[model samples]
Target: MSLARKFATVGGATLGSRLLGFGRETLMAAALGTGPMADAFYAAFRFPNLFRRLFAEGAFNAAFVPLFAKEIEANGIDGAKRFSEEVLGVLFTVLLVITIAMELAMPLIVSTIIAPGFVNDPEKFDVTVKLAIVMFPYLMCMSLTAMLSGMLNSLHHYFAAAIAPVFLNLTLIAALAYGLWTGADPLMTAWYLSWGVLVAGILQMAVLYAGVRHAGMRFGLRRPRYTPNVKRLLVLAFPAAITGGITQINQLIGQMIASTKDGAIAVLQYADRVYQLPLGVVGIAVGVVLLPELSRALRGGAVKEAANLQNRSLEFVLFLTLPAAGAIWVISDEIVRVLYERGAFSPATTATVASTLAIYGLGLPAFVMIKALNPGFFAREDTKTPMRFTGISVAFNCLLAVSLFPIYGERGIATAEAASGWLTTVLLFVTLVRRGHWEWEPALFSRVLRLVSATVVMAVSLHYASGYLADWLTPQARLLTQLTALMLLIGMAMIVYFALAFAIGGADASMLRRNLKRKPRPETAQEEADTSVLPPPQM
Candidate 1:
């Protein structure tokens, strides 16, 4: 498939998943609010969720996809399958052991590592521990699912893997609905949700495994042995995993700091959910498609093609994210109040969440840029450099978060995250340029400048538009009125932004049109032969 079509397939599915995620968050806001129960549930969810992101989504795929693709191209189907089986055997064994250990150590982890603040409230602390234990098995399921997803993506079957997350949201939403209908206690409802997480993990893994099978790859469990390729994969994956772990650790630090204040953790979680929509849809989708594509291009000695793809991906990300960041910053309050601020969610909570979302919005472009740029290094199997950069960013985040938390509270934590994101993006960009892995063309730079200008125009328009609808956005406004005003405001802002972008030469209308119409490039024998001698990826 064309790059744009692959991106759309993954991006569209991700959009569906994110929309359901928003619904799930909305229900949770109404059902649990920012109370202790909400805090406990989110805190519990955060522990396993962080590990899942690090191990399953971020690090594993970064290392797995490129190698798996190389194997498929070079060694054919059977070679790829054998490699996958070896990796799976070792991976499953490791994950199984870790899950068992974590389950046993849940109390210690919850009390010290995950949410130390909960220690002051014995009930909350105990509840968090229980919920975490219930959800811990999700780690194993998702880690395995991630491996299967790598296989599917390598085979150019992106939809099933991309859409698997919707099941998680669906499962959670159902649990929340049942809790409400049955009038279950808040703690009981959280318990139900934790179990739902486990079930969803299993279901998501099953879906992806089925996809891999349908793609004509069947994996069976074998003795846990690290064959030569598996050993190479592990070596490459270790640094990437460390990088992912550092990112997660930064998040954990923020959560720990947020946990000191009542309801701060939940507030951060809610804000994160809001910004994650754009991040997942654009940033993640680009990363997913770009890595394999770049790897293939480079393997085929199509360096120019690889560079063009990177430039286009960067342009697309900025084009989308800049406007998204602007709109979110402009209408954060209205968005938050409309989506949340119901039931037990108070106006004060809404305001806090809105401010947090605004700060996160400021970093949205940087976050997306990181996603786009990292693939440049990763596709060439240069995980160590990114790992080093991630370390620096995480250190900065830790120091800044610690310094600012006393003054700015949860907003400080959000600010630290945004600042660190930009720092990481800049570092990655500089490294890429220095290594000649990425080059900034004049057109790309000009377009980026124009995109920024267009975003400013959109922001100014949204500022006034929001003022005009201030009454409808108020907490006391009817829900329908609030929703209608918010939707219209967003729609108008999108129209203004795109129009300004096109007028200012910020966007390439023809390029996008071509992207939509471009045909898939068939794999050539020369390309396969080129990949046959693909040297083992550098550590």
Candidate 2:
């Protein structure tokens, strides 16, 4: 499959999940607002979500895909199957250990780590602990799902893993619907969401397991064993997990700091869901595909192909994310109000979330670029370098957030995260260049500058369009009226950006066709001649 198609497959699926997630968040705003229950639910959920990214998605994809590809190459499907079962047994056992420990320590964890601020509110503290315990098992389910997902990605079956997240959003939405239908109180609504998370985790795993089986790689349960292979995977995965979850780590750091203020955690989460649309679509798609694809290339000693893939991935990411960042930055207030201003989401809350969203918008490209760039190291089995950068970023996030939070409130945390993200992105990019792992193409730089120009134009256009819609986008406007205005404003921005991108040489149809469409390998000189042309611009 063409890289663009692969990205589209995953990104399209992620786009579905993210869209459903928007509905879920909208419902959540109505059901919980930024109340004690909302803060408690989001804060508790962040723990397992953080671990899911670290242990399952980040760690396994970084450490497992390359090694799994090696197993396939060295010993075929059977060896790969054997390696998978071994890892699964250990993963399952370790997850149980972690879950049990976490469940037992939920109270302490919540009081100290998850939300120290809740301690002063005995009811909120207890609610957070119970909810966290109920949902901690989600970590186990998603960890197993990640193992299955890594296998599927290595085998080039992207859809199931990518689409599995839709179930989480679906289940949560259903839960919210039920809660609203029953007119459940905030506390009761939160319980529904927590249980929904657990159910979705199980459903998501089942989907991936089915995908793995359909891909013709079946595994039998094995007794827990710490084989040499498992041990090596652990060594690699420990660092990779940290590296893979730098964003989550930074969020958790922010969460702890934000918790000191009531509703700050939930406010950050509202803004987070908005920004996560582009980040999840473009960022997760790039990270999921790049690692396995790049690993296979390097493993076969196709260094140039690997470099080309990285270059193209970077280009494609910027093409999509730059304008998204622009739109988010330009109309953040409208976006927030249009989506979440009804029900318990008041105008004041909208203003707070909008500012936070705007700050996060500035970091969108860097966040996605970090996902694009890290694979350059992980694909080569150098997880430690990225992990070191992650550590540095986390430290920076902590220091900056602490220094600024008191004076600036939640916006301070947002600023810190954005700043930290850019720091990590620059560090990763420069290191890749210095280590000769990346080849800076002159054309790629030229295209990026052009894309930036297009984004600036689009931002200005969006800014003016938003101003024109200022009246229609108000809190007193009918929901449908507000939504229509927001859509038209966004539609104008997209039209302007894409038109400018093509007219100004930032992108072209031939480039899309070249990257998104694949042709059969030519088998003859005449065929090769017919196929001959300048390759698509990298990314």
RMSD of each: 2.6, 4.1
Q: Residues 230-323, candidate 2: write the lDDT tens digits.
A: 9989988999999989989999999999988999999999999999999999999999998998887666555656677888889899999999
Superposed model 1: Cα runs more than 4 Å off: 245-247, 515-539
Q: Please give the CA lDDT of all the candidate structures.
A: 0.87, 0.91
Report the error of model 1 at residue 294, Å: 0.8
Question: What's the CA error at residue 479 for candidate 2, in Å?
Answer: 1.5
* Error at 230, model 1, angstroms: 1.2
lDDT of 1 by residue, 1-539 (tens): 67778889999999999999999999999999999999999989888988887787776678899888889889999989988889888999999999999999999998788999989999999999999999999999999998988888878899999999999999999999999899888899899899999999999999998899999998799898868888778777877776655556777889888788999989998999999899999988998888888888777666656767888888888888999999889889889999999988999999999999999999889888888988888888889888898888988999999999899888899899999999999998987788677767998899889989999998999999999989988888999999999998989989998998999898877667664332322454455445434334445
Q: Best candidate per lDDT, number?
A: 2
